[model samples]
Target: MLDTYFNFLQNIERTLGGGRGVKYGLPSTLQKVIALFRVDAAEIRLNQPILAELRLPSQFGDFNRITSETPYTEAVITGAEGHLGTLVLYGSRQWSDNELRVVHLIAQQLGVALENATYFAQMKLKTSELKWIDKFGDSLLNMLSSLQIQEVAGRIMSATKDLLEVEEASIMLKDYESGDLMLWSHTPPEKDLSIRLKPGQGIAGWVVEYGKTAIVNDVKKDPRWEPAIDEKGGFDTRSIIAVPIILDDEIIGVIEGINKVNDIFDESDAQLLRTIAKWSAIGVGNANTYEALKHTTEQLADAKKQTAMAHMVLNLAHKINNSVGAVRVWAMEMADELKATPHPSMEMRLMVENVLHNAEETLLMVRRIRGATELRPGDIRPIEVIEAMETALQFSRVDAAVKVERHYEDGIPRVGADAERLVEVFLHLMNNATDVMNGRGTLTLTCRRAQNGTVEIMIQDDGQGIPDHLRSKIFDPFVTSKSDGLGLGLWMVKLYVELIGGKISVTSTVGKGTIFRITLPPWEK
Candidate 1:
């Protein structure tokens, strides 16, 4: 036994002197210990990363391993950083005092070696992370050099994702117009699960709202995490690190690395993310500004085209109205002539009346077209509000699976708005809500007095909420989330609302729900 101890010490010295780093040191030390003790099997299970020795014939085969609930003798591997791992051994007989002392000494040696290994591994990781950081810095510079704002935005997303080599990454930009977080970009590029977070809604939302760095090794343990995002993204979020993109003392957005490929997120990862965010803030800010301007330019072009089309249609409508007016006068005269003949055939009289009715309907439709092209604001009291909403619901004809909720406060302020346009706005908004809910979920409508004495109205639905990319553009024409939509519903809704001396805005969360708020200028009777 004393000779075996000498051999083990000599082998350990050779392993330490080999200078092959800690990878071979651990298993080699275990092999030497096994040979000295003559154990049937041996294993070393790490604590931090949960790594364990492979089941080679010489190392281990079949044995339960744990700090507790295992049959084998357990040797605690203690290091400077608390317990490093556990060394389980299977020996045929109980150890003598000398043997036990030898085991303890081996474990102590292993602990020191493991502590050194852990530190070395960390340094290596830092070196690798620094390389990634350097790459990201170069990518940011390239992105900044690009004149295309959209391309720059996309590169920022890919660079951040590659910086940490995480399974998934996302960038959520805040809409200062609505105070909502919009998913700016996501990777893997194929999984374009457009996500949106209401202010202070989820982990990313929390980071953006508070302008803080969040490094969560386990999302399940964090209160700020919203698991619904995982369902939307189609992944299990084990860990996350989120950092805010601040510009000019304002949190413009949040950048996140989710589910590290092989490890949990740590300060080094956070530091890299923070560094990227700090350097890319100007780029992100400029990109967003350019996007907003581009979107507005497109909207103006669309609006101009629509205006020209409406002008031409209005002219045609006027011609149709004049022709129909002449027809109605002729029909009236014919009806009068038919009435004068007491013995006229009933069929002939009926024909004359039908012509008059058709002419009158045509004229009414032409007038309606004119009315729709113009904003005609009028008194909109609670009665008109209820009627318009009910009429809209009737028009939309939501599925039976959709539940409706209506709340009207006692002092619901009366506002001035075009009554007909109001119904159209509600109709379009409700139709959108129905589509998002997939014919199921609850639709809530509320009308009350706001703090500023204005009438506040809300149309809410528990549904698959709007995507972040399209959320800010909900009121912009040709920006629809639906696979089969003209994308003009919310655009019309906004147009009508604003034209009627009111304001409309929306807030949404992916898979949770959405709410559209409307405020109208109060009008006293």
Candidate 2:
């Protein structure tokens, strides 16, 4: 009977292979054994507190003594070397003498078989861990090849959850200056676990602060764990294991796993978690460095562009100044000659009037150029949308030729944007529409409130719509469909719109006209 029972335990391990080996293997065979013993239920409780089954033990009839009122019988049977063992039986009546002998025989062999099965399980677990590590190593290599920090961190969290076989996993980054740990990435609760930790607070923070791994076998009992996130997440935590992500002696982040599948996390989980932490640290460091370099490069480029623009502006101002001075002198000379003559011919008077008008226009043009160039970021004002549109249309001198329609929402709040830039934006759009219409089509300027508390300004044209392929490049610098277009008009308009924290988008279909929408944050009225 002992040999037969040993064989039954051995076969049970083989029956429950793969991921189910740890869960479905023992309880099932143990149930059959309970039936054989005529007990209502049977269980194999390993290391206490892990109860697999529960029932009144009075039906088995396999115990010689009953010590507790529960009427359960428990025995300790040793293996080849007196190893720790457990066998419990309960029943209503004593078994037959032969049956009792068979029970003892089965108990003795059960101890040896359970020991072997447990050892086999440990080996299989180790093998599965190795396979996981290999897969993780391959994935790490691929992520490294791409040099994407967030993607690598995301993958690391995912791998940590899978390798640790936990309910959830997350990676938290440490801010050394603020001493705060921020949640970076995580395998969501559905995939693994969901947890958030602050610096020097939860397991993740403690690991980051100390630059070491910390294991909490039961999170519910750990005082270091907080209930801060429980209200929002609506889930109770059971266990946690956090490993510090360190790179070059600097603590960067923490990788954490929550709720092990069968039991508390062991050495294998610690080992894999540490490995992932190390690689994730490297990936995070690379990402930070890349971002820093990118920011620096952008600053340098902007500085250089500003320097070049300053030089161009100075040169342009010098040329304009000289030309304006010469035109002013010519206009004064013509006025003087008109006054000196007794009756300056009608043609001469008309010529002098034209000269004065052209001089005033040139000076105004110079002033407008200077104003456009001098405006900077953060200079915003509240200009009525209808008023700005009317001003731009009047300046364009197309109100007579083109049908200018203004649709302004009453009580619309003002927009926090530079008035000059906004005018330029409207002017560009209106000018482009006028050109498209050959100065004869209807141009509508509509204003309304946007979904995000921003003001939406739409400038629609009734002329031929932009081609689908050309719409994308319409705002690009030096890309224009018009033969006489400077191309910088729309480009400058886009720059000013974006500079004032506004967004511009165009939607057009062939033969249906085009609409340009500009959205700007509404100002406090």
Q: Where does the lowest 10-residue lDDT sum fall in candidate 2?
A: 49-58
lDDT of 1 at 193: 76
Off by over 4 Å in 2: 1-133, 147-299, 375-381, 390-411, 416-424, 439-456, 460-521
Q: 18, model 2: CA deviation in Å?
A: 36
Residue-by-residue lDDT tens digits, candidate 1, 237-300: 8988999988778788998888898888888888888876865675554444435433543444
RMSD of each: 28.5, 30.1
Compare the candidates by lDDT and give the number of the best one.
Answer: 1
Candidate 2 per-residue lDDT, tens place, 1-525, comes to 434434453454354431124344445555666666665443333442222221212223333343445454455543323434466655555565434544444454444444333433444455566876556555544333322466666677677776678987777776554667877777573443344465688777778777778888887788778777655565567888898878767777888888898888878788878876765665565455444433543444454555565466546766876798798899889888889999889988888888888878767655654554456555767767767777777777465778878888887777766666567668778888988888888989898886567888899998899977788777664578888764556656665676667788899888879999988777775
Clashing pairs in 2: 57-90, 58-91, 58-92, 167-192, 167-193, 168-192, 168-193
Model 1 Cα shift for residue 241 (angstroms)? 4.2
